[model samples]
Target: MIITSAKLFEEILAILKDEDNIFVIGCNVCAAKLRTGGEPEVLEMCRRLEESGKHVVGWTLPTAACSIRSFESLVEKNEKINEAFCILVMGCGSGVSSVANVAEVPVYGSNDTLSLGGSSGGKLLSEQCVMCGNCTIGEFGGLCPKAQCPKGLLNGPCGGAVDGKCEVARVNDCVWTLIYERLKKIKRLDLLYVIHAPQEHGFK
Candidate 1:
């Protein structure tokens, strides 16, 4: 998901202030969950921009703006989408790139996609999955040491483990403990005794 900042939004507004007609396109899939560009967000932005005296030509949210096929259909149905002087994209960086590929008009951004993470609570989420391709959970009892460990260490217990809890947060469960349970369930508890050496993994 992408992260949006107030400064970024102000800068975007400054750029489009001169334009009369503008289109604010949002993505419903990842961007929505990420709190970046969903349909509701696009509408809120439209209202604010209209208040600023810019004419909002049209606004719509696509299921997955990054997909070429989905965006193609959205563009076909929303003919007035291109009628605007500029387009503001509310998806990740890939969405902006895809929109630019299919349109000749100027494109803008409404958020910054940092990394993939899930929601923690109401209007709040955190970076849990770092998207490190080299996964050792299968060998580590399926507990994802990279994500569960407080230090994200590949080796066994770190100094941060305190009384079976992580030093970072007392409420947080130990990653190794989770690993042990998962390993035991799969009859691979013996694998926990073996230490895994860190190795570089490259993205495809």
Candidate 2:
């Protein structure tokens, strides 16, 4: 899931400073899971806008605000959206961009997209992937050093690793240590000798 956090109230107010009639759009998938751009959030935003003396024309919770097709469909069905001078999207960056691409009025985001993460527990989000366009977990026993390691080391732990903990972030376990333990447990230590070429920096 794409993790997100609501933008500061003051920041949102500044963005809508010139706009009186506002329409809100929220995502029902990732953002909803994060509780940043869900139905309740949209309603709360409406209340806040009304409190600020701005007229909220309407609000919608689309199935997937990041999906252009879903957003376009919602816009087609909601003619009342046209009454608003601008739109406030309470989803990720992709969702905000999707709305801006198809909306005639100006569109602004009310949330800041953080990372590709999974729900750890409650409101805690754990980042799981960096989308590096390469998959090397098969050889590393499913632990991604690129994402887990602060240095994005692919081969092994940096010299700074201490006592099975990452040097960059002492609170986190050293990804290379985890990788070595897993490989040893599975009798795949031989794979460690195989050196990988540097990742291609260009587009995949």
Candidate 3:
């Protein structure tokens, strides 16, 4: 899931200082699950924006604002969007981009997406994938070194792990140590010897 956190109220207010009429939009999928941009969040934001002296034109919550087809239908039904001089998107960056793609008015994001993460325990998620485009989880028994390792080491441990704990984050287990144990468990320890190419980032 896409993990995100709501921007500070002061930061949001500062961004919208000169703006007046605002149409609020939220996501009902990942952002909703993360509580960054859900129905309650949208309502709270609308109330807060109004309290801050901005005229909130209207608000809509689309189930997965990242889905182009689905969001278009939501947009079609929300006529209040036309009255907005600007849009405040209470979702991830992708959601903001999706709104911007269809919206003529200036669009803004109210949250910052952290990482591609998941949660087993309620409301507690951790980064599992760095979204590097080329996934190599199969080699490391499904554990991503780039995501878990503080140094983003792809090959193996940096000889910094002590007693299975990471040198960088002492509280966390060394990702390579975890990978080694997991690979050993699956009888695929041979994969560790193989060299991985450097990551090709989308941005410089």
| Sequence-dependent TM-score of model 2 | 0.86
Instruction: Enumerate residue pairs that collide in model 3.
Output: none
Using lDDT as the measure, name the better of candidate 1 and candidate 3: 3
Best by lDDT: 3
Worst 10 residues of 1 by lDDT: 1-10
Per-model C-alpha RMSD: 4.0, 2.5, 2.4
User: lDDT tens string, model 2, 22-132?
Assistant: 999989999898889999999999999899988999988888888867445866757668788899999999999998888888999999887787765565545567787
What is the per-residue lDDT of model 1 for residues 18-100, given as tens digits with 9 covering 90 to 100?
66788888888887866567777888888988887888899878777787564457667687885778888888778888887
Overall lDDT per candidate, in order of appearance? 0.72, 0.84, 0.88
Residue 24, candidate 1: Cα error in Å is 1.2
**Better structure of 2 and 3 per TM-score:** 3
Best by TM-score: 3
